[model samples]
Target: MRRAISRLKPLWLVPILLGALLGVLGVLDVVPDFVAAVPPPVIVTAIALGVVLFAVHPRAEAHQPHRMAAPVRGRWAALNTPGQQLPSHGSRFLGQYAAVDILRPTTPATPAKLRKAWRNSTPQEYPSFGEAVYAMAPGVVTATWSRSRDHRARNTWQSLVFMLVLEGSLRSVAGRAALLGNHVIVRHADGTAAVYAHLRRGGVAVQKGQQVGVGNQLGEVGNTGNSSEPHLHVHLMDRANPNAAAGLKMTWTDITRSEEIEPSLAEIAKQPEPNAVLSMPRNGEIFEA
Candidate 1:
């Protein structure tokens, strides 16, 4: 069921909505004179087009997990990772099925720090802010966006509610740029594209069409776009245009260690021996690479 729904592209809604609108106008005889004068066959064709679009579900192609260098160094906690759940960001839309969010936590994890962060905090207050983001593999930079401003953290309960009810809706309607903030898309030799989003304004270090090697600096993390806090959002897609692309699974090739952050934020417990090649870290799992 989920797979079926994932196959329903947002672009399909255009024809469906258009067909419904024309049908209503025709039935009510309220369309403009030219529209009303349109032959019945034209209307039928439009409606039929909509039906065909609805029935045609695009395949959400999957690829074998690509092993690449981790985009950041030091200790960072992973959230919304593919290891924790499929469609890691809660939707297959935008080719984010294997996306992961990572943020650096304060040393000696403390409940008070977590509580303070949850209550109120600035984007710059987080350790992840301004930290350089690196390219995970060799690629040509296909696209870059850096205009969106980093907004205040929405971690507070009130702000979180506002984001869910209003800000998120506005961002969605404004399109990908408004939602991804500062971002970079790098297309690898094998055709897979790596996307790094939620970057700090004015922090983009590379330009479109530039060749970048593995570990090249891309930008810095920020709380821009649809984000609640400052973090780096990374994913691999089949192509450069996320709207038309399918997500590809990815694994980190150089993780040195990992630990699980307790729910209370009071304890950081070590996990099993770190794998040289690591799957996406689960939510609350911190790792060094």
Candidate 2:
């Protein structure tokens, strides 16, 4: 009997279940009048949720670069982007050790994961993470925050669930550290501030008011603050504070170009291969040197 059923496609189960649900609804007399006169928000919501859960649900076919081979050398693990992987120096320090997506790359790992409305996936395009992530034309570390314990992956998920639960509960924020948890804000020579968020706990290698070069190691990556995974979140802003700052226009040197209005996750997952290099903005676009 088991062997006999194995040959069947089992496509009829869907209609059978749907039919049973409708039959139960009819017997309950919930929609005795007009049948279609009123909108069934419950049924509509269930169907919509089912579709979304099916699409974003984590499965074997879903994109997951974390399970891929460690792309970089060293013991530090790298941050993951949509299509590409940035070497964090092979550090498992993020999960057991420490580390830290975009506006929302739309993590399909689970239904409760945050949905990214937009993401900034501009790869620095070098052999390793050390190649770029520059000093932003030189600056001093005006302020730094270290010493937070690296939240385990389980904790990360718990924090995400809490935030999603309270997503619309807050009216506005007067001051919230959740925006930039455990980070360093360096003021560039041109007065532009580069904010690096979700760094490793007690891994900040720099000090307050210390002048450092472009390639100086500030700290190990960690899952601190409001972050989903282990990756350096760098975005230029005019102000030093995360709450009051607006992201600035940033550019890099010696990279390949593939500009998209809205780049897909498939493209970001392909990065970090050995010797894979890419540049942004094409040619002739002069950025702050």
Query: In the order shown, what is each candidate's alpha-carbon RMSD?
Result: 6.5, 19.0
- Residue-level lDDT tens digits of model 2 in 1-289: 3222211213322333454466688788774566446467755655554433322211112221221111112222122321222222121111111112222222333222234324321111111122122343467997787755544332234445655575312211211234345678787765557766666666677788999776666765565565444445555554454333433333344232333222223322333444221222211111121
- How does candidate 2 fare on TM-score? 0.43
Q: What are the runs in model 2 whose C-alpha is more than 4 Å off?
A: 1-134, 154-160, 167-176, 256-264, 267-289
RMSD of 1: 6.5
Q: Show the lowest summed lDDT stretch of 10 residues, model 2.
A: 91-100
> Which runs of model 1 end up more than 4 angstroms from their true locations?
1-62, 107-120, 262-278
lDDT of prediction 1: 0.75
Q: After superposition, how far is residue 133 of candidate 2 from its true place, in Å?
A: 7.3
lDDT of 1 at 155: 65
